[model samples]
Target: MQKLRQETQGFGQAVPPAQSAELIHTNTISRGTKFGFLGPAVISLAVIGLAPLAFAIWTSLYNYNLTKLASMRFIGLANYANVFSDSAFWQAMGRTFTLLIIALPVQIAVGMGIALLLHRPGIGFLKTITRLSLVIPMATTYAVVGLLGQVMFNLKYGVVNQLLGFTGVSPINWLGVPEFAFATIIFWDIWQWTPFCALVFLAGLTTVPPEVEEAARLETKNWWTILRNVQLPFLIPGLTAVLILRTADTLKQFDMVFTMTRGGPGSSTELISLLIQRVGFRAFDQGLASAQAMVLLVITIVLSRLYIRFFYREV
Candidate 1:
């Protein structure tokens, strides 16, 4: 027993000093190698993201106008104050919120319904085709979608008007009138993004354990009950992602609204993004635009945090 105890103690003794030093040296090299691999990505982020943000913040503190570059001077928070006081800015923000309120619920509901349909057992070929079709709107460029909206919603020559004529209804001025134009934009957004939400929800559904679903079905005949009690928990992550992405996209909606309406029919459809564009480019008030943009960034970050806090769940 004494011999065995000595052997065990010897085996458990600290590593040789030379070997320990070698191990430490090897660990240092490994850490250095890891940082070396990460160096390019860190540098790229600094160059591509932080630099522009810093520049924008700096520009926001000055009275920098693209047209009057030589007259540019530091104005501190004047631009930010001006933005908050601008009635047009508030109107644009209100319109943006209106769009968000109207569109998000409809998109979520329709998308959830579509996801439920797609989740069911179906013909393999049909399922594959349906899934592929959902990608079409997402794959289409935003600018192209805007242009297409213009062609399709024209006052007289539009396909929509022609179809309405066949149904004995008057050809409505879809894009010419303020209310119709806003509604048309809403419809356009819903059409383009519902599939994206559907696909995301479908992905979430796919992760649900089959045994759990089967057990739920055995307990409840009401599909709604099973969905609420069993399936929805799995969908929280996807729902959170959809909310965050869609909210951000809607707030920054410029390309489609710009190409389609140009914020026109007399500023009725002027969203916050369009307002920023007009201030920065048309009015040449770079300082004001930068301030507006920074305010918008803050709003986006706040809303994203709220969504994550309330809805985010590990799946």
Candidate 2:
């Protein structure tokens, strides 16, 4: 027994122990290594990231007029007060969140389904074609999508009505009415962004082992069963990433909606972005705009941080 113990000790000493402190330390990187050199780079990025935000906070407290920079006065919380009091600002914010409620789930589900289809083997050409189609919409300029959407929804001669005309249904105003305009923006969002969500899920799907999928096939189950049991667990990380990204992007959306509807009809579809732009540039109310922008920035940051922390902790 003593001899056997000695041999085991020798073997253990030759190989690093599971709980060894030295084994826990990864890599043998030197102090002079390139990664070590990134200390300065990290500091630079920290400064860059925080500087503008600090400036915005400072400016939010002051009355900053680009035309009269010298005339700027320190008016703490007044701008913030005005923004809170503005009924239009609240209305626009309500509409923005409403859009998110309508669009996020559909985007995620449809995108995941598409990604699943693309993951199947022996369909290389189909995957390529589908990816190309999805990429085109995402790559299209925001302004161009807005313009095209307007053209397609034109009340006078819109393609939407032409299609409905074939079904003997009355012509529907796609953008002229408040509800229709709101729905139009939501549809545009789904069209342009579902591809991005799908791309993320597709990226995740590629990392899944083929053997696992083959095993799932051997179970003699339907497609939905395989997807629910096999695919979804693997896609948790990717879905978390997509949700966080889409949430942030949807909240800050400006160019597409403004160009398409410009907060039209009665402020039914007016988003917080349009409201901030109006206060900042159009009305020359920089202080109020900055305050509103700060409010928006805070909301997004809080929500994103919470999402990352809670759902995407590993992300």
Candidate 3:
């Protein structure tokens, strides 16, 4: 019994210590490898993203005007104070949010409808063709889209006006008028982005298990009921991704709007982004623009946090 016990103890002492040492060594190597792989990316982010952000914050503290570089002096929080007091800044912010409020829901609805249509079981070739068509708008660059909008929405020689002429309706100055111009911006955004949302939702739909869908259909012939109860759970992740991406994109929307309107028609489409551009470049008030940009950054972070906290769901 003593011999058996000693052998067991020896076995345990020898095997466990050796295995433990090997495991510890492996863990150290794993950690070192992970850090090694991550080092370059971390350095790049610090250099590219954090450095600029720090510079912007520093620049915001001064009365930096490009026109009067020699007169540039530190003004502390005065630029931020000016931003809050500026009516134009507030108006621009209002216009920005108004676009987001009006456009997001329309895009989601239209995109979801398109996704549902595409999700229906159909001829394989036709489905491929239809799905490929959704990529057309998404593949177009922002600048190209803006240029296309100019040609399509032109007052006289535009395709839109030509179509209106068929019904004996007068050519509407789509981009020249303030109200129509804003609507045109919304329309262009919708046209460009709806396909993206549709594709995302379609991917989500594809994840629905065949057995689960079959069981769901057996329980109810109502498509809405099946979609709500059986399929929506699978869509949560995709929906979250779409919401985050679209929200960020819309908040920073500059290129297309810049090309299309240049905040024209008497500042009608002067969104916050355009306001920042005008202040920074046109007015050459670098400090105020930096302050405005920092404020926008804060707003974006807060809104993103709100979306993640309230709507994000794992599936």
User: Which sequence of candidate numbers ranks them by lDDT, best first?
Assistant: 1, 3, 2
Question: What is the C-alpha local distance difference test score of each model?
Answer: 0.90, 0.82, 0.87
* RMSD after CA superposition, every candidate: 6.5, 7.9, 6.2
**Pairs clashing in candidate 3?**
none
lDDT tens digits by residue: candidate 1, 162-275: 999999999899889999999999999999999999999999999899999999988889989988988999999999999999999999999999999999899989999999
Question: Which ranges of candidate 2 are over 4 A from the true structure?
Answer: 1-49, 67-71, 313-315
Backbone-clash count (model 3): 0
The residue ranges of model 1 lying beyond 4 angstroms of the native Cα positions read 1-31, 313-315
Quality of model 1 by C-alpha lDDT:
0.90
Q: Relative to the unseen true structure, what is the Cα RMSD of model 2?
A: 7.9
Clashing pairs in 1: none
Residue ranges of candidate 3 with Cα displaced over 4 Å: 1-27, 30-32, 313-315
Q: Tens digits of per-residue lDDT for model 2 on 11-56?
A: 4443234444344232323334545688788778879977867777
Pairing residues by index, what is the TM-score of model 3?
Answer: 0.90
Order the candidates by TM-score, highest first: 3, 1, 2
Candidate 3 C-alpha lDDT tens digits along 45-164: 999999999999999999999999999999999999999999999999988888888888888888889898888886879889989999999899887898898899999999999999
Q: Residue 204 of model 3: what lDDT?
A: 92
lDDT: worst 10-residue window of model 1 = 23-32
